[model samples]
Target: MTRSLKKGPFVDYHLLKKVRSSDVLNKRIIKTWSRRSMIIPEMIGFTFAVHNGKNFIPVFVTENMVGHKLGEFSPTRVFKGHSGDKNSKNLKGSKNVVRKK
Candidate 1:
């Protein structure tokens, strides 16, 4: 479920303060751990260093990214491949097989 329309978008007060005080954009990266906080128009053009559990990843907020969560830009999990041996005979279909001469 999304946030109630009556409450309005949830932007961290501290973050808003930091952003409001700064006038430069793309010059400094704002380091923050508020991944759950929603992105606002004031964040546009600013680059943020959002923490992804282990380290901080740079995230540049644009007009298109407004109303989205900070965490969406900084992914936490790494996608590996599916399990199983490539040479296993149990593999489906023998499309690449050739008959012995």
Candidate 2:
């Protein structure tokens, strides 16, 4: 049986369903950030929002360190070169994703 959309614009109905159940969508978001060469499994955060459109609603969010970087930007933010601060050392001595309480 096909899944049903809860409510929203028709265009977003499709997109939201794709976002909700598609590993491909999730991986694409992750890879886009990774391609920009950001650190991961760090102190980045997650957020979700419901976008109501003319036709349907879409669930939108950000994930990983990329989210933190995006959030750090200010309207007057200026870009200097990367700090060259590779926190990769944090990965040493620990498993990739440690389940915390």
Candidate 3:
């Protein structure tokens, strides 16, 4: 469910303070664990270190990222592709196999 429009976007109070104090010219990374916080217009041009479960992943905010959750940019899970079957390896080593249309 989306947040109530009347209440406005949920930008963390502490994070907001950090954004306010940070200088856009310096390009400093503002580390934050507020994954639930929404990205606001003021956050554009600033780099944020959003915490995943294990570590902090850097996310540079841009106008296109506005209205999205901070967590959306920092993925929590690692994708290790599907495992190949035992026969798949043998098939790869054999180049003489022929295919019919």
* Top-lDDT structure, candidate number: 3
- The estimated TM-scores of all candidates read 0.83, 0.18, 0.84
Distance from true location, Cα of 20 in model 3, Å: 0.6
lDDT of 2 by residue, 47-75 (tens): 22222222222222335333232223212
lDDT, each prediction: 0.89, 0.32, 0.94
Model 2 Cα shift for residue 101 (angstroms): 77
The runs of at least 3 residues in candidate 2 whose Cα sits more than 4 Å from the true structure, single-residue gaps closed, are 1-11, 24-26, 29-60, 63-101
Better of 1 and 2 by TM-score: 1
lDDT tens digits, residue span 1-101, model 1: 88898999987898989899997643788999999889988889899999999999999888999999999999999989788787775545666666678
How displaced is residue 34 in candidate 1, in Å?
0.3
The candidate that wins on TM-score is 3
Worst 10 residues of 1 by lDDT: 89-98
TM-score (C-alpha) between model 3 and the true structure: 0.84
- Residue-level lDDT of model 3, residues 11-100, one tens digit each, is 889999999999999999999999999999999999999999899999999999999999999999999998879676688568777778
Clash counts per candidate, in order, are 0, 6, 0
Evaluated against the true structure, the overall lDDT of model 1 is 0.89
Q: 1 or 2: which has the higher lDDT?
A: 1
